[model samples]
Target: MHNIMIICPDQSPLKESEKWLSRYGFHVNTSATIEQANRYYEWSEFHLLLIDQDSIASLENASSLLPSHLRRIVLDARPSLSTGVDSMAQGAIYYLPLPTDSETVLKHVVNALEQHDDTPQTDEATPSQQSDEDAFTLGTASSGIIGQCAPMQALFSDMRKIAGTDVTVLIRGESGTGKELVAKALHNLSHRHNQPIISVNCAAIPDNLIESELFGHEKGAFTGASTSHDGLIYAADKGTLFLDEIGELPLEAQARLLRVLQEGEIRKVGATQSTKVNIRLVTATHRDLIAMVRQGLFREDLYYRLYVMELLLPPLRDRGDDISVLSQMLLEKACQKHKRPIYHYNRAFDKAIRSHHWPGNVRELENAIERAVILSPPERVEAANLKLASHQSSTQQGTATLTQQGKTFTGTTLDDYLKYFVQTHQSTMTETQLAQSLGISRKSLWERRQKLEIAKK
Candidate 1:
């Protein structure tokens, strides 16, 4: 029988896990101390080990006593961002934060088993983006987009139905709502699947050079244009061009872009010749473009052109399966990318997942999972596995600040207070710090910021 080691300070959760693994036909070995786990590691090789977060340091210290690689994983019940990151950087195979489920555990384990080939071949692992070269197959066969919720199913259905057509697409969503993912899905499922999906972030580009970038420029059209160049739109001739933050494009650029959409052709900045394109336009924006059009911030014709088909991605709070689906998906990716044996999310970790309203959506979820993966050891993850080290990030990442209730000062709104706070302590303050000082819960702080319109300074 294969060896399975589980280390815990408490007996109840350990006993529960023992039964869980035993039912799965794993020969379970339990330990109450890190010293015993270390001693056991010397005598036996484990298929998987589950370490309580309290004993994580012990397991890591034991790693130095061994010679070659052994499958290990950590179960952190209280996860701090730093410790999790530090654990992985120090050589842990997998990290599972508290309140995690059996399914999340199973997913990581399967991924890890597949990654460890026993062939003795050296393959360094690194994380990769969700790229075209690695497009996900359709149906329930993939782990790419995680969801069993109605909203996700509907969103998927909408994408599948609209992808095959050449109709322009308008994707509306708040920041972190995965608009880019929808855009990619549209292109991936479309007739132009093989062609490139060129992405241009409208807000990131400056107005002075926006024209030269969208349309080709003749040599000497502007300063430093020593060579004639093809523009981004031309490069995406037969594919889909994703215009992100489309509402940020200035009025002048919007007019020229509208002409291209209206005429299916573009003229160079300084060249007299015009070029035709056979591209599909997919635009996304966090702002309300319809309102913008009414206010003359957006062009009506351009709006109509891209609004032929529309899709809106829901935020993480709205996604009912936030914990199960995303945690499992991110775990699988982490195991595969790191070439480590998988682990499970213990009960404590799962609770946090359910309790926390993810302000950063999928990206934040991914970060949390990644932190768990890194903090964990190669052992299986358990409920008491994770430890939360660093505080929450909202106030730190943005300029949104806060003011004490009923403590009004001259020219001071909550937004102004927050801006000053962010500038002063961004490098050190976490959401916990602010909430602690404000005598509020993290969730309450988030709501207050949103209500106050206290955007990042």
Candidate 2:
């Protein structure tokens, strides 16, 4: 029989859980506190430890007291996405939300035990596992997503529910937050994995030819049309079409797109016949399409069709310690790609990453980590080596620096501040660098420049 220990402050659920486990033939013990649990732990070796939300400082604190052989599961009396992330970050084998079915609890316990039994034992922590308490880990990397933070876990849960269906998904987030990766994950996990997942960046296509690029064009359809060509929608038949920055799509194209979504058919440019296509549509945008709709820049009907199911990706800064976790993964990949020696980071590195507000999100973080790997002298990477935007300027405070005229920043709009800052720094910094420093995506910076009418130097 698998042995178990439960540390709980409440009595009712404790008794209820104990009765349920007993019925399943588990060897069980109970304690009211971590101190009491420690005493109980000294007497009997437990295969698993169940701790309620109230008893421990945090899951990390509970993890410190247990020996490596003893696995853990967390019981959240009040469940929320953040608490679930905290549970996984602390290395809990499973997380059980409150009001969970007793049989569900039993099932999780058995699965945890079986996994623990299957895993090979090691006497000491490996180099990768040796780290400070705040370091994040992606224990669920098999899902093809990298974050173990609460928001990411919540997104992962939502993705699993909808991946099997053919419903249209609109992914909304700031640029560099992995909107494309989320789209790809949905396609890979869906029924059309064998087919090509065609991607089109709406902003990159010229307004004059976007129609022909999205819908196939017959020969001599336009000035340069020498041969018939299939558009992204046609190429993506029997597969998925990922439209990145869909908000930038022309209003004319939006009308056509709405028709395609409504009728599941496409008409080629200069062609009398329309062809039927079986395609799964997934679109993502960093822009506010709703606001654009209000401005008459995007079609309301098209927006509604794409927004049937929405996935809002959280920014990197809001994901807590996931920065550290993603840093390690990116560092490993970068090292391999660049032919550099593997380098571990110091706690100071972890501290710096956790403290900085990642404005550029995952994309910016990946670039910084890769640069550190390339520049460091085969030594352990430190905070300074990463060169994060938060440390970009010694004199600048927060997201923007004070102007030379000493204008009061409190009264200024964010757009004004961003425009002023970019104008001041554009001569010395590239647009990409300037965007990173401002904590906005490059595309956002470009839009800001257009609205403010700032001339590119």
Candidate 3:
């Protein structure tokens, strides 16, 4: 059994977590202040320390009283990016946002203990040092992109291979998968790293203004042309120009862009002379450019010109454990942005996140987490806090209504519904099918089965 100490001013909030930890066969002790925590540390060898944010200053002063090998996790009731950074700077293994459920606290404690067990004990080596090393092994830390999965690893490998070349590259991904980041990475790795990378969102510009925006306009180009203006393309001379949502570009602008790629020149609006320029082009879009070309919505020549090299970014649902890692990272970012207390989600929230398809990808996930962080009460976030049910499919929404013995049961509690549904369906449906119908993972289904004592047929 591992021993843990929690240092906080109030004990009420943590009592539930303490009880859960004890029930799981771990010994837990709570201290109302840093002085009491110091005395407890001196009395017994502790595997981990859960320090409250308020007690951090006092704990810092009493740091010399603790050993280097003792694992420490800071729990913040009012979490901000700065406080979390300070805790980590002081050698904390984890910084938990408050309003976290007991299950989340338990998981963090167990993971911290496991990390302690794995660390090679020495006078110089520490868990934080190992964490830093582990971060590099993920392979895209320097690129400002986070992914440990095989698809992302392959994408990173491809990116490295192509980043050095000046070839026109096209990035394809669902919105919010960070295509712009990939485009920036390509620019940074290329020879044009020192040059400016002008980014333009094609869809954001009006149809009439897009042509003038991409290819500079003369003084008398059109209505409201008060003065001659250099387009974004001219600004990117001898550098990289990234056009996001390229499929949204008007056909007229597409023709102008194609000329720049082929002839290496741009003719400003209302100008008779073409100016010679050298620039690397990188474009990204969530639309199907080929389909647009066929539909006459986009120019085929330009589509072929921009499709020289393609980078396909996988959606969040396909990244497996990356979702969990990203959630924590995004949670911290949201907390930091809003200057709110760090918060954590319960097991139900985690389950909801994993089960959701995340149609909008990482962008949607970030927004959801940010909303939860702002709206949720201190320390813990429940599944309802995420409001994922509103985004669920019609089939998933219908799961609440059950038909049994020629009667419809819609008023049953979640436990009553789960018990009835599983027992009624297990005889006919496969486990995977059952899980799918219930809109949850097989692991969650199994856990519910165990919790409610509903055996499979």
Best by TM-score: 2
Please give, for residues 256-373, the per-residue lDDT of candidate 3 as tens digits.
8988999999999999999998899999987777877787888988888999999999999998756865787788788889988666645677788999988778888998998888
Better of 1 and 2 by lDDT: 2
Each candidate's clash count: 44, 0, 12
What's the distance in Å from true for residue 264, model 1? 0.2
RMSD of candidates 1 onward, in order: 14.2, 12.3, 15.2
TM-score of 3: 0.58
Quote model 2's TM-score: 0.63
Overall lDDT per candidate, in order of appearance = 0.66, 0.75, 0.75
Query: Ranking by lDDT, best first?
Result: 3, 2, 1
Native-structure RMSD, model 2: 12.3
Q: What is the lDDT of residue 406 in candidate 1?
A: 45
Q: Between the candidate structures 2 and 3, which one is better when assessed by TM-score?
A: 2
Judged by lDDT against the true structure, how good is candidate 2? 0.75
Candidate 2 C-alpha error for residue 91, in Å: 13
lDDT of 3: 0.75
| Candidate 1 local lDDT, 99-143, one digit each (tens) | 567766655555444435533322232334224213443213232
Candidate 2: residue pairs that collide: none
